[model samples]
Target: MAVSGVLGVFKDLDTAIAGVDALNELGYTRADFEVLTNAPYPEGTFGEEHGMHRLGLFPLVGAACGFSVGLLITGATQMAFPLVTGGKPLFSIPPMIIIMYEGTLLAAVIFTVIGLLFESRLPRLGSNLYDPRITAGYIGLLLHAPAEKVSEAAAALRRAGAEDVILEEQPAPAAAKAPQRKGASA
Candidate 1:
């Protein structure tokens, strides 16, 4: 389903924060809006609660994958090369343990990277609700509301001191390749 929203641009931090609060007072939940800025603002700077992230399982999932891969390699190698030493067993656990440990670590790292991308919503090839001014020092507050309520949201943003207000039909999805900056030599 398509989500309709209003984007409010504020030139100052305080005004931007006020805009966020105004949105909340307008019956918009925390989930209904997002803040965009050229600079980092500490969490809750705008009375907006930063959403809780669920990253509890990424590491465990990664470790499990790594262990399985390690085991597969260790087992396959041992079977492929049956070495005989002085009364030594053909399958040794000590060496395989090392391989398994390394594998687990490698998989965990890979999975962590994948999980970060998922959490961060990377490779956005379809975002449509961005303003070029955001990169030029304008703080933006984008509020998602029902199509019927778009006008009301925009008005609230204006009352809260938004420098510029833009009503977009839907937030555009981000593109896979982030767009190149303007005015730089190709």
Candidate 2:
């Protein structure tokens, strides 16, 4: 099914909040629309439902994997080539503690960064509901609605004092690539 998106630009935060409320009244759920702003705003600042995220698990899983890898590397190296120093026994705990600690910290930091990017929906591939005015301190409320409801959604946004509304039709499905002709240019 074809879908269309609308972006309602507002110059004031209050009007933007009203735009969100207007969309809500038009039978649009929080998931169907997103608020865009240039500055950081607390979640649910506009009374939108807080999105659930699983960022907390990333660090824990990374730490566990790092600890396991560290343990394996230390143990396997010691077991593979036995080295006697100061007549001490192999698989020494004191030295292994340092490597394991460092490994755990490194992996945890890496995973936290990964989780942050994932949670923030980075690299938005084909988002068409964006307006440059948003970067100029204007707030944008992007709404994804069925093709039939595009006008209705735009009207609702206008009622809420939207300064301008931008509409975009979702791209059609990609067509199959044309087959190369025999003896094509090298």
Candidate 3:
């Protein structure tokens, strides 16, 4: 479904919350809208009926998996290539413990960073529906409404003290190109 929308910019969280409440009172549902803020606001303040914040969870899970994998790799390597030193055990627990700890921590950090990047959809080279004012501490409430309801939605936002109501257009998808063959001359 071609999703068209309007974004209502507000000066602060309070104004944004008020605007969302007004829209809710005007028969707008939570599924039809989203709120973006520079800093996180309290849940339910902007008529956000669902507690759906899951961005942080990705890094935690990634870290756990990374730690497990790192431990397994260290243990397997130690078993496969035994190194006997002056009266030292072939598979020394103390030294191996240090290696395993470092590897596990490294993996956790790497995976967490990767997870954060993936979850945020970062490194996007294309433009997206965004307002510069949002970075200047303005809260933005974006509504995905029917084209016919655009005007009404904007009006509702204005009535609720929105500083600016702007229609956000989706950027056309870029055409896919064929991949070049490996080892081709530059």
Which candidate should be chosen as best, given TM-score against the real structure? 2
Worst 10 residues of 1 by lDDT: 177-186
Q: Model 2 shows how many backbone clashes? A: 0
lDDT per residue for candidate 3 within 1-49, as digits (tens), equals 4556677889987788888887888688887787877877666676666
lDDT of model number 2: 0.79
TM-score, every prediction = 0.75, 0.81, 0.71
Which residue pairs show collisions in model 3?
none
Which regions in candidate 3 have their CA more than 4 angstroms from the true location?
49-74, 81-92, 123-127, 169-186
| Whole-model Cα lDDT of every candidate shown, in order | 0.76, 0.79, 0.69
Q: Which stretches of candidate 2 lie over 4 Å from their true place?
A: 81-89, 169-186
Q: How does candidate 3 fare on TM-score?
A: 0.71
Q: Whose lDDT is greatest here?
A: 2
Instruction: Supply every candidate's count of residue pairs whose N, Cα or C atoms clash at under 3 angstroms.
Output: 13, 0, 0
